[model samples]
Target: MFCFQCEQTAHVNGQAGCASTKGVCGKDETTADLQDLLIYQLKGIGQLSERLRALGKPDQAADSFTLYALFTTLTNVNFNRAVFTGLIAEAARIRDRLRDALAAAGGDVSGLSAAVSFQPATDLPGLLAQANIASVRAGLDLVGEDVIGLRALILYGLKGVAAYAHHAEVLGEARDEIYAGVAHALAFLATDPDDINALLAEALALGRLNFTVMEVLDAANTGRFGAPVPTQVLTTPVAGKAILVSGHDLRDLHNILEATKDKGINVYTHGEMLPAHGYPKLHAYPHLVGNYGTAWQNQQQEFAAFPGPIVMTSNCLIEPQPAYRNRIFTAGPVGWPGIRHIQNDDYAQVIQAAQAMPGFAEAAPAKTIQVGFARETVLGAAETVINAVKSGDIRHFFLIGGCDGAAPGRNYYTDFADHAPKDTMLLTLGCGKYRFNMHDHGEVAGLPRLLDVGQCNDTYSAIQIATALANAFGCGVNDLPLTLVVSWFEQKAAAVLLTLLALGVRNVRLGPSLPAFLTPTLLNVLVEKFGVQPITTAEADIQAALTRQAA
Candidate 1:
């Protein structure tokens, strides 16, 4: 499989891969092929969405269908064979309907990719059997690295869009434009792999559309959850049966909390799920417990040591160690070859898994970990934070955000955090914070300089805070006394970077490394248009950013 959807792609040109047969992320040849097919189908649907929109007939079902399909394809979401096939079949039907409609409308779309036309039986298990046995693989050996990288980038962005769209749909909110954009993006990746300039343009376009999608998701989350507040979540799991829920789906967390309520089970957040504590609806669950582990890469050790069952809601799930294999359950899009998966969206199976596993045993509760700084909470503190800036108490604002990974170069984030100016306040979100969350960066005038604004979804908080500060200071966001130093490892981070670019946030530094997916021409466009840079030494980069701001 020639995959380069992440920063961790095997080669810079994208021709290299994690593994020739199976993915480094535990994905086998079959899964990778299925993911490609799913992307293909979604692109078809995207073409349909645009056609419908042109005809003044935006389809909610089409939008939802694309969202669900994309969500299923995201990293670590769906591994369950049966669940994936069902979604693919559903997407196929939708694609067929749209293709027929487009054809009737005299839209000569006969050259569409085979992904749109592929059919799967409605029977979930049957489809799974076919996919599992068919031995489908990416024909990447025939393509150059740059083409592979660009397509991977496109696919990853669509996955992120799918996730945001799913969150919006959860809250009864939908954006047809965003859905159409994602679908169109997928189609572009499938057909135009060789167009370097076109790929770069699409990457930027993905970024722009993602920004819109994220804003919609932000509204849905904050509106439904009553905004995030500053609160510390305990890491200790209380005594009793417990289930560790990881990944980014807050709605699933709430549902689990509801299911486990009064059932003597404790729930703890892990990885991206740690931000769940900031949500009023989620944190209100007394037995919701605390965070179980750090970022996604540490799951092997963390899950191994855990005392109970675990449920994954989204990406960053590694293959389970044998020690904890029996106790892990896949929910939503996350699936593993051998893991038990919850079906029918009922989540009853997850609850049952928690009951069967050893429940949480009594453990000592520790100091609270501070969280909750979404748009509302940060806005509430605007007066104080602003006043501090005005009084010279807060010297600099450093937005250190992006994805977390296991690569050695990732230590750059930890070192950067360690070396940042003492007076500089760190506003971070996403798994990227995994680098420095354990470090003690002493307070700055009674406030913790290293402030976490929840998960990647909460990156909106950082954006809002920047915009608000700029408005308060009567300047554009770029002119505000803030710097964006990002660390990206995957597609969601790419989406976030695009959002920053779309908003005209300039002089942003991204690392532990630049994405292998970007062609030289594509990279040049971003550098010229946005002044985005790859990270160098922390000291030098920080000094340069500050000097530029001072000038």
Candidate 2:
């Protein structure tokens, strides 16, 4: 098994990807093969779903399941081999279901490839034997590195798209086009086309598709919880029986809050869930106290120290350490073999565990940080922002954010944010902000020098703010006085980058290192075509952005 669909993939002798028994994410070869098989099966399901849709007999249930199944394959989301084994069978059943409908609808399924024709095995060894059907690195010698790299990018982007769509879907949002787009892209993958130009177009199309998915997710979030407002979140803990909610699922956090209400339990947000505090409906829960930890990578130490139960709601989970493994709970797509999982939004076990353990022993003073500078809050102050720029009070903007990792060079983001000019505003989101978010940036023209846009899930908010500012300044988004310094770790970041490229937003400096899946040739194409460049030094990149602004 070979897997390099993330920023943290193993590098052996300068060759990227983890081809050993285990991946850098701790996903063993068995798990990796199962994920590959699940994706392969999803491709078949998608092929049939696409064909059925074209015949005007779309399967909505299969579409929803497709989104959820694709999401489970995302990096750090699921590592349970049993879960993957089950999903493989479920995917096959769904594919067959779609095929039956297509057959009835007179949609020809003849002459299709194995992805659409092969049967899944009943046992683990049998399934593993068929892993070749969905090998990520197969035929690299024939198709070459660039083609394989492009295909991985598209497939990973689909994972990100599915994750976002699934979150929104669970929050009561759905679109037929989403189903069609996902199915179409998956079907496209099944053909294994090596045409570079066609593959690039499909990648960009997936990016555009993600833009709509992001919109639906944004609407789902704001509609259910009200638009995020700028609010101060306390970083210190309070005295009570406590439960820490991590990852990006607000729905899980909300349910935890409700179940623990008046039960002597205080809920704290961690990782990407930090932005949940800014939502009116969620913040209204007084028991939902401050944040407990910094980012996902720090969870081993943090979770070990936390006294109460910890619930992981979505992605960004690392292998649970023995110190806190028993106390930790996985929900939604999150899973670890022996760890208890909370299903169906039921928080009884979580609440009971929180009640059973010791929480924070003492209440600390509110050490607050500003959050929720989303599209609404940012655009509401557009007049002030515009005036600040016109009056030379704000020189530029730097969006220094994305998933943070334990890798060495992550300091680039912190340094980039720290070394940014005082006149420039720093816009951040996701766990990457934890690097320098606590720094006092002072105020630029009555606005804080740093603004927290939100979680990575709220990337739509960042894009919206950029578009609004561009429109206000009467220029293309590329022409705006802004720089995007993105630190990506997983597939969601891949999707975000694709969305930016598809929107034609240029000069995004991505680091801590380029994706291993990207062969040098593919990286060159991105650099030449999209102005994508790897991060150099903070001071140097900062000077470069300023120079571009001056020119």
Candidate 3:
């Protein structure tokens, strides 16, 4: 159907839709349509919040509910039919109430109401049935060349907010404003606007709000997990039956570790889960063995040959092949129709799956990957880090965070890491670190040139580290000798970027390409306000970023 929710939309401006039988990402047509509907319904729920708030009933605002709902609709969170259906039904009820409220207010809100309308045309076929397929293609069509960029930017920002809000809810942390604000903004974006300037302004506000939501999520994570500490994680799979856990869900990782503790089954982190090694609470699980696989896009080949069962806790789930289908379990929001998905948020099914599958009985890894640069560990070494900076031993801090993909261009990350100067330090989080995490770049002073700061969600750790450095330097975050070079492939990355923007962190570099959703106006706003730029050649980008610091 007409889906442009990700950076990998078909190249054609108007006509390139996901294949009807299969998606570019291996998602079948049904899943793609459902994702579209999920977003549409979330918009409805968001519209309802606007109504409740306008009625001086701000207390009635259901932020947690809206945020969770939107989060569920994010790229790779939930995929269970039952769960998806229930949420859709709930959203429908909320949408109906919103329609009634706006109608009764005697206010002409048709424009805002369009997104949530419970009409057949909202279904998948109806959407794809448009005679001109070009109309549904991403970029240069939906919002027009002029405004498409802006709309995409705001939409992506909202998606980021929804992700952070989602994580916050997982930890029992609720912020009504984030939920309501995101929903209201989504509803507004869906509105048929006659004033382009007004839309652009709101879009900018969405970026700002996304930042605030990310900070809240950061606090929630650190508060619950304890500030991440510096620890070493192994990449070599250990002996005995092993289970590989991927995606960005720490809670899921915790549950799996708890379920398999001393059960003769060892657990390993993959993709964004690699950062789990930093949390004392999580690392305490002795059997939580090292990581496996390189990055998200390499899953098919990696997972196929792995000698253990694999569990996905979040995004970047490649649809499994028959060769490894039985050995895999999808948990949390990641779902593929034929795949065995965890029925509940619980880990019982995952445990059972691991038990039934053939797993590793090999020896411990030859070497382990280092981790644990979270706030506390880094701050604890604050004096050492500060001194190093002062001595010019650690000349630059490169914050390389974001998702990993199989695109040829993704090789830029590896090259950049390989080329980082001897005195420069690379602080990496998220699966993107796969490019160079496995490589030993030697050390800067006593510290490893590359520090694995945990998973994508652990962007919190990066922020904490940056803030501490800024405070020590008596300057804003940007003024600190740090740079952010991020690679995004999903909504979670979107949230992290928004958080950076919200905090007014400038001069960040994003690559391999900008999202297809952003309209030109929105892109300009981000470039103008945040100084965000696309990544160039690894050499050029690194030199430019480093040169800026020397300036």
The superposed Cα distance between candidate 1 and the true structure at residue 542, in angstroms, equals 1.9
- lDDT comparing candidate 2 with the true structure: 0.91
Residue 252 displacement in candidate 3 (angstroms): 1.5
The residue-by-residue lDDT of candidate 1 on 251-296, one tens digit each, is: 7787788878798788899999887788888788899778888999
Global fold similarity of model 2 (TM-score): 0.99
Q: Indicate the TM-score of model 3.
A: 0.88
Error of 2 at 131 (Å): 0.8
lDDT, each prediction:
0.76, 0.91, 0.72
Q: Could you tell me how far off, in angstroms, the CA of residue 378 lies in candidate 2 after the best superposition?
A: 0.9
Off by over 4 Å in 1: 11-15, 80-87, 103-151, 187-200
TM accuracy, model 1: 0.90
1-551 per-residue lDDT for model 2 (tens digits): 99999887888897888999998888999999999998988888888988888888888999998998888889899899999999888888888888888888888888566788779899999999999868988778889989999999999999999999999998999999999999999999988889999999999999999999999999999999999999999999888898999999988888888888788888999999999999999999999888988999999999999999999989988999999898899998889999998878888888888888888899887799989899999999999999999999999999987999989998888888888888999999989999999989899999999999999988899999999999998999999999999999999999999999999999999999889888889999999999998999999999999999899
Off-target runs (Cα >4 Å) in candidate 3 are 12-21, 56-65, 76-87, 97-112, 120-143, 194-196, 519-525
Q: Which is the better candidate, 2 or 3, if ranked by TM-score?
A: 2
